[model samples]
Target: MGITQVQRLSAGALKPLAALVDDLGLAAHFQGDAMLNGIDPVIRSPHRLGEASGTAQLLIGIAGAAVWHARTGKKTDIAIDIIDALHYLHPTHFVQQQGQPILVDAEHVEVNDIFLCRDNRHVMLEAGPPYMKLLKGYLNFFDCGNSKKSFAREVAKWDSEKLETAMATAGLPACRAFSREEWLAHPQGAALGQVPVIEIEKIADGKPVPFQTPALSPLQGVRVLDFTHVLAGPRSTRTLAEYGADVLHISSPAYPDTFAQHIGVDVGKRCAYLDLRNADDLVTMKRLAARADVFTNTYRPGVNARFGLLPAQLAAASERGIVCMTANAYGHSGPWAERPGFDQNGQVASGFAWKEGEPHKPRFSPVFYLGDLMTGYFAAAGMMAALLRRSTEGGSYHVTLSLTRSAMWVQELGFLETTRQASLPERDSYPARMTSIDSVYGKVSFLAPPLTFSNLALPNASRLSPYGADVPEWPA
Candidate 1:
């Protein structure tokens, strides 16, 4: 059964959550079931995107707060606001500055929507600033009139499958739209099926270090080295930061993200710079890794592995057991495992786009960036669960998830067809869900943490800062 707006998570409700916990090998770590704090219908979406992500929030909130529970014999029984529970998934869409909603330069035909190809099929294309340099040469070939329609016209001359293959082989993000059945039959889909929805595995042996005295939040005193960009990866570390982990987000000054994106994702953490290519900078990061409790990377799986920052590498660099998380697009075991991708690519490749718009127009889910954002919630839960496991078992653990994998899991949860066509709320309609902070970046307000702890707090402990604004070193 597909989940919709659930006001309260009854005993029999949220069966999909349990199935996912078993799939991720985290059932043993869960102290008990979680619940929702408020009524739903807060988020607008056809699939159970809101409910699935909301429940994911509930899972991680309790997992992090459980650290406090372990010390004081408190049950960290938390209730996620059925409405605000989904706000964090699409932070930019709801962020406010001086009482007005912030705007993201998110639209461009070159990287924006579906294009019809020669074979009468469709392909999703993405060429964001970070990867545009690599795609420039290839995209310029289709530079007809230098207009979006001209670009679409040129795309129509190429077969969908060939165009997708060429783009992916060049390390660019592109995927042909496929129906649910067609996706299930593709090699990439078959490969993804072999991978778990989420993977949390121990990779090294070490001594257990119990949780210290509970203080500000559940993850007080814990240090997280965040080497992630954009959504999924950053959101995971952001959640940890809110729960009292000293999260230091590392980004290179060489390649910068739009200031809007930085504002959306940098909340609850200190933004710093470190060039991994520089030997001295690498040493600094290694030293920090050796002392960190959790490390998160959102780069394509092997990109950081080349720099000796992979799970096993980080585990070896550390003195004690640590939690390492890797979030990506396709998945680790697939033929397209290393393929670079974005949220819409996941939707296109995994049949969501087709499901939403078929025989007419290929469309993305109504919710803001469903695939990538939902994966963030999965990453956060996996990290907290792995950390909880490491504190008791004493082994470096690795947590892994992908946008495509999250899309597939949501399919398994079932969609609420009856509510699929419901009228939705517009932007800034609910100010109560928004939280403001006098951040280092400035006075800013955005979506709060989706879940609330009965025993802990919300709004996190830190302020948003511009990228590379802080020194590389962790807080002393």
Candidate 2:
């Protein structure tokens, strides 16, 4: 039998929102129009990027409200402005520190950029820290230095196929751009098409546990153990923090991230460091996991399994059971499941890069990291749904999300092939969308939370914390 589409909103374009609610089995709890109001065309790119991003944000907001209702028996209305929601898709771009725009792009390494191969094909190399060691090996093998131009010149010596094969063999992250037809026929692309945008499963059984009632925010008193880095996972945890989840972000000094990469997203969360390989640190992590309501991580599939920190393991340790959420580059299934990747690689593999420019010349999506941003919001929604299930059904749930799957959702949203020409709305009105706050870095201006509830004021700008600034234990 073919899949049945559930119709909740009268607007056909909002079917995705309805589909998301139904997929999460949250149709009964959702109230209000299926489509989020005032977000049409705010993103204003070649595709309905803005609409999809806004819809994801709204879904998370609605889910957060639903969780609140579940705890307090009080229902609330949710809403989002299109422009405000769009800003969330690129949080770093909108951050202002000390009355100046913080330069967010400087963290990108020069060697980690797009280059043309001898076959006239373009390939993107994600030379970020996660792959820095492997990338350095590749660079040294090619006798190339730290210059983008030098890397490009050296990479031109080989065809795209050869370079791609070499990078894959070396365990470095890279993807050559492909045309729409080429991408559809790719094995990994086909596999991704068969997977759901968010995968949720009951991993362990437990006794019923009622959600803690909140005094101020919906998620107050909920403790979250966050072992995620970069954007997608951190952004999701950040969303939980905005709603009053007591989130403690964990990082590794062995694998360091720069201040610029962590600054904006670190708001409203305490930060700490832990080297899981160390015996004492591992014991400390297990203690935290045993007490945490949720455990979220972005490490690839088996990386945490080595540390005995997999979802089932964490669930076994917790007395009340716990919700586990994971986000990654490719996904948990298929040949690329264990492969290293980043948002740029997902965009290229998912045909976004190919479609951004002409057939001969490909362009990466420069506006935002849609894969990371949307996956963050989608993962947040899944975590909330799992929490709801735990509250009612008494089981530990695992929610898995991937950048590639998010890219497919964006593709499914399709492009806006309109004949009418349009330009982005003026930025003079943007000041109205921002809020100023005192932060660890300095006085900072940030975009307000895009989604809103009738009963709640916009969440205060996140209180920024320096990396590893807090102890590794939960608050008393």
Please, what is the whole-model Cα lDDT of each candidate in the order they appear? 0.74, 0.76
Per-residue lDDT over 1-476 for candidate 1, one digit per residue giving the tens place of the 0 to 100 score = 22233444346566766666666555554465577654334445445655677778776765665666664556545666555655555667877677777755454434467889999899887765335564574466565554567768878999998898887767667899987778878998988777777788889999987878756567888899999986788877877887778889998889766677777777888889998899999999999999999999988766686788888888987988789998888887758888988888888888877776755687876654777678887887788777777778888999988898888877766654435445555332445465688865467887655665566664346577788888988777
Measured by TM-score, how close is model 1 to the native structure? Answer: 0.91
Instruction: Report backbone clashes per prediction.
Output: 0, 1
Give lDDT tens digits, candidate 2, residues 249-346: 88888885656568767788999999988999999999999999999999876779889999989998997989999988878877778887888788
Specify the poorest-scoring 10-residue window by lDDT in model 1.
Answer: 1-10
Q: Which residue segments of model 1 deviate by more than 4 Å?
A: 1-10, 22-33, 37-45, 129-131, 134-138, 418-432
Instruction: Tally clashes: model 2.
Output: 1
